[model samples]
Target chain A: MFGFVNANPKSLSEEEKAIYQAFYCGLCRELKKRGGQKCEILLNYDSVFLALLLSGLYEPPENSFSFKCAVHPLKNREAYENEFISYAADIDIILSYESLKDRVHDGGALAYKKLLSSLEEIYRSSAGKYEDKAKAAALCVKKTTEAEEEKVSDIDILSSFTGEMLSECFVRKKDEFSEKLFSCGFYLGKYIYLLDAYYDYLSDRKKHRFNPLHLMGFSNMSDMTDFTEPLLTAYISECVNAFEMLPVLTYSGIIRNILYSGVWSRFNIAKKRYLSKEQKK
Target chain B: MDPYKVLGVSRSDSDDDIKRAYRNLSRRYHPDANLNNPNKDAIEEKFKQINIAYDQIMNERKGGAGQSAGRGPGSSYGYRQAGFSDDSAFGGFSDAFRRNNERQQQSDGISPEMQAAVNYIRNGRSSEAMHALLEVPEYERNGTWFYLASVASQGMGNMANAQNFISRAIQLEPNNPTFREFSERLNNIGAGGWYETGRAAYGNPYGNNSSSSWCADLICMNLMCFCCRC
Candidate 1:
């Protein structure tokens, strides 16, 4: 939901990049198919990662064709068509609707209600199809709000809720690999929650919003940068270890790059920014 | 089953090669990773065989080496005999207690509260142990308190807190081999190797003994009800 699930483009090979782009556009196409054109606006990197992970785990057959869309009217872009992409698109709509509802509740935008109402039918259909996933997402949102209201200081507790929610999303069906999927999803979710808190620490502190890393005894962003890098690195290592256990036959290289070096690339950028801000201060 | 064949390793394979092969095969056949396979039962059976094969080979190798070196720490038979005596009471409290006691400075004897927490930990009452530790006065907290707190935190799956507390324990007693070794284990968690061995040796903090998983399931069930309230 935070849109932190991005692959390191530099680390990807040309073919992998092409595959990545095709999938990205493929999600966009599915979003339009399921939720209409307006839903395309809700496309996020997190759902793309979801599609990639599912595709890797399921090893479903893929088909792609070049097509020109509104975004790229002059050039033909390859769009992947697959079951996982469609599933991820539906999930994207559900998450977007939930986030919009949250925004409406926070009193930030009354217009968000109009968008929510427009997406209500699509959201309900998707939610009905994936009842367990929808329930998990709703529960995580509810618990996260409760934690924020209660001002919970423990990073693990706060992240665990998010982790469990993502675990549910990763589980397409209750199969033998469900436990590994849950473990991988849990750690990645925890890493994202912590990363979001770290990234938003400065603004959250200024706005008097709840930030778990800030509350976890970190005096400033610099201290947070130092502490979270190692912790996040450990989580990534766990994720990779679990990932390696899965019998992924195709696109394993791409997934490996994203998990191993891609995540670290994002972390370094954030660290550099934090360090620069500290130097200025 | 031939241990080498079961692990898909050659008879001439080195220990590291055997270990690598086992790790790969186990990951592939692990029940969690093979749920959708039609041969789930077969895979599970094979996984058990692989585990048994690895253990047999390692034990045989250890036995041979132990005989050459005489009776000592390297002797697997001697070690197991020693372990049997320690495992008999409170699920092997003698070993853990003795190790902790050895690290205790001459003037810094184990407190009753510390002893009670250790007992709770041994009995799988991690929450109770955590509660007892929390009740200790701030000034009275020492390396032992922090070390035990790390164990409690690890049991709760709060690795961040576990890492912090264990690091504090190491800082307080820099030369304590047990503390340093535990710290290294915490640091290398999920990377396998020593971490796995340490977890098996010292006992799993997040094992079936903890009720946290049940609590989580209950909370999730209630939350599902709440979400479905139309």
Candidate 2:
């Protein structure tokens, strides 16, 4: 989920945007309350997407509240709340905590060492709720960190770990749609992982770190896209294929925006920046 | 009757031995073999039982569970459980899906293992197709082999392998229309059927060669305007 998935703002209307924000704010409040200020810092649109997706699928009871948040003390905003929203927050909190554990074990993110026990206390209370998701996140985080350190560059295998991780994350409450949900998350997870790699290619190159596209031997961004684009599209297309089959009429429009176009927000930015630089060179 | 018991083989018997038993039982007493016999009704009933037993046993083996006993005649969904149904637009898959077992004749000079792989793929058993393809000796893998591998890979949710395999098929038999058509579909699958709903230039993520022609990026323009990021 790596903080990359986002809804494209230009595509949404004022009302739709507010609706989206209501849920986003709802998730933010849940995160802050459950995982504390440090955990709130880990809030991302990816988790919000998960929440909204599950909500769209299940259409759980809505719990709307009007309140002034820490960010908007002058104006109280109406936030929509639901069990799925809280579930997403717990997921966000647990994944962040697992990430912290990974950093500590890998002896990276050293600054977070002191906060581990505190986050662990929060995680202990929350992990029980979504034991499946926590276990998957913990294992995937550990494996992903290892893949990075060991420089495992088989893109499919590397991406699949994330796929499997988020696949578990997607099936919050298993029903007949669980398989489709898992497939949706699996391919979308692969898409996000590949997109992240492509976006970080130059930066990782400068740092002499692992980026799967590096193995493709692209002399320029265009060449890299030639290899990555089809694979990426294939993945996201499979995601949409599953998404279409899901009975998610609630946020289908917004979810379609994300699946069809919004997910490319980062890619658009990364490609333009790299191409323009290459032209200058 | 228990399919294994009807077939006169225990579950412990190897697949080949069971298959041999079915062949022998069906051959001597098959309806076609007993056209003029006085006991034709009983023979036909016995033949029907033999067919059902074999199908049930195969379904059980394919699904790896005992619950396959009462499934419909075909276990097509067993393979599709991997997600992403094979595009039936490809010409051969429909016929393959309709195929009954006992197709060991290997028409068109295809290896028996490749034939088996095709049947597995037809039934949506991609992992089985993969195994069958792997069983084919390397010397016999033709363009059809690579093409079948692509189909099986796609069924298994391994599109990377599917793309790679179909490309190999094209390279080996460039003029094969089926291969060419499949390659085109495989390359452009996800982007199709999407542009109709999305007004944004979603087809090409990087936009066209013009660098600014990407008009599909803003689909669902009235939905919302504040998708938050980290």
Candidate 3:
């Protein structure tokens, strides 16, 4: 997804692309800084944007270095100073922990056990660094999984669970934008829940497994576009608006482009393809 | 910014008209339906107008009373409005209400995870977005996350996930016009009469035609597209 945004036709210049790559590389380095080498593997564009968004608060160091990694030794990329990179790394670790945790529960037995054993070492190390957040995210996922197991059909219950996880990531600055970030996470969590169900619908159906849509009896994807699009736009608008409100400055344009044009365009293509596939059949 | 104007109601329009207008605009701009429309400049304009108009009408209706704050006794007595409360003292309350709303708006920026989720969403990374979003703390989950995640999943061809997220959003902020519209849109899926009729038409006794993936997809698509557009 970040790759798509980086290459998107946004009328951006060569310099802008380089800056974007720097931010991306900065994020990658940060993941390594905070979570160690293994954590760097979880590095992705989203966390890079997080690094960029937070970058507004602090100035980047005067000196950046172009370094090669084991995977991309030939492709020299620019990385930011330690702190910016560190922030990105921390987020990666935290995010990776939560993601692996979710997977462990979602995947059955062998897969679950394998995930747990693999994650145990990483979780132990990262949890100490991000103690409270890691713990809170774990609890939230636990509660959420329990609810799902109990056949909890309540949408609010699950959304709140996701929202809780998002709230743990931020340091809660006194600035007004802090609250907006909270709201952004809130809505995004809700949107993700439904999308997860949608993506897994056929498989769940085939497996005769549980899905909220089946629980709710939803029939098709188009019908849901109406249900999902407006709230998304509203929240995205709010997130953008809040980011604009912040007195602190950094990478606002990059974040904004990714949110409005980048995200929306991708959604359009996906929906268009889905519709086209339906048409083809 | 007339409330009546926002709701597309006449100055003297009935409450029902105001309600109907709100519903119509809500349906039209409700995020779920307008997915991937490329953020048209007019849509934002329309949204602003509707919000302002609705706010104004709601204020007037809520605050208007005998116009007793001014004017002569007879005029004040005769000025009693039908819909508004008699307690006109709180007339300036709407300003405070709007101010609070503004403050709420000031708080909603995208987090790094949200940015990633959006990226994943754009790239059709439905599950990845879901996984990325899992990092967001509980208190942080708001209507925007749910909506965007839902849209992202939909783009990834995951309607069930979209429905689940949208439903969670609606539950969190039940009265949000956007959230409510989203929920309604999800509810309408697969429940359309046309699909049922078409399914009936394309029935197979021995083969159970509806069970075939191709037939199911076609019937669902046709019925959904036709029924929803209406």
Best model per DockQ: 2
The candidates score, on chain A by TM-score, as follows: 0.94, 0.93, 0.80
lDDT of 1 by residue, B1-230 (tens): 68888887886776557667876787798888899999999999998787667655654553332211000111111111111122331123346557877767475887788888877666545567788998889999998899889766654445687788988998988887666766665566533433234223323231122222212343354345434531
Cα RMSD (Å) between model 2 and the true structure? 14.4
Better of 1 and 3 by TM-score: 1
Model 2, global lDDT = 0.69
Backbone clash tally (model 2): 10
- Please provide, for model 2 over A1-281, each residue's C-alpha lDDT reduced to its tens digit, 9 standing for 90 to 100: 46666676566667767777888778878877876565666677788889889998777889888997655577787899899999898888887788677657756554567667667777887899888888988888878888877877778678877888888888876444566677778888888889989889888889776677887677788888767777887787777766654545577677876777777767877888887888899
Residue-level lDDT tens digits of model 2 in B97-214: 3341223235446678887887776665678888999998887787888988887777666678888899898898777666676666666554343422452643324323212211
Give the TM-score ranking, best first: 2, 1, 3
Candidate by candidate, in order, the iRMS in Å equals 16.8, 14.2, 21.8
Residue B112 CA displacement from its true place in model 2, Å: 3.3
For candidate 1 chain B, the 10 contiguous residues with the lowest summed lDDT are B67-76
Q: Which has the better TM-score: candidate 2, or candidate 3? A: 2
- Per-candidate DockQ vs. reference: 0.08, 0.09, 0.02
Runs with alpha carbons beyond 4 Å of true place in candidate 3: A1-11, A33-37, A60-63, A108-116, A154-157, A172-177, A207-210, B1-230
Query: Which lDDT tens digits does candidate 3 get at residues A1-281?
Result: 12222223243356655666676666766655543544444655555655666666444563578897554566665766556556556655666667665765566546445544655676677667767667767777787788888888755456556555654454323231344344444444444455455555567879777776567655566665565454344333333423432333345555655544544444454466556676677
lDDT of 1 at B190: 39
Comparing candidate 2 with candidate 3, which one achieves the higher lDDT?
2
TM-score to native of every candidate shown = 0.70, 0.74, 0.52
A141: Cα error in model 1, Å? 1.3
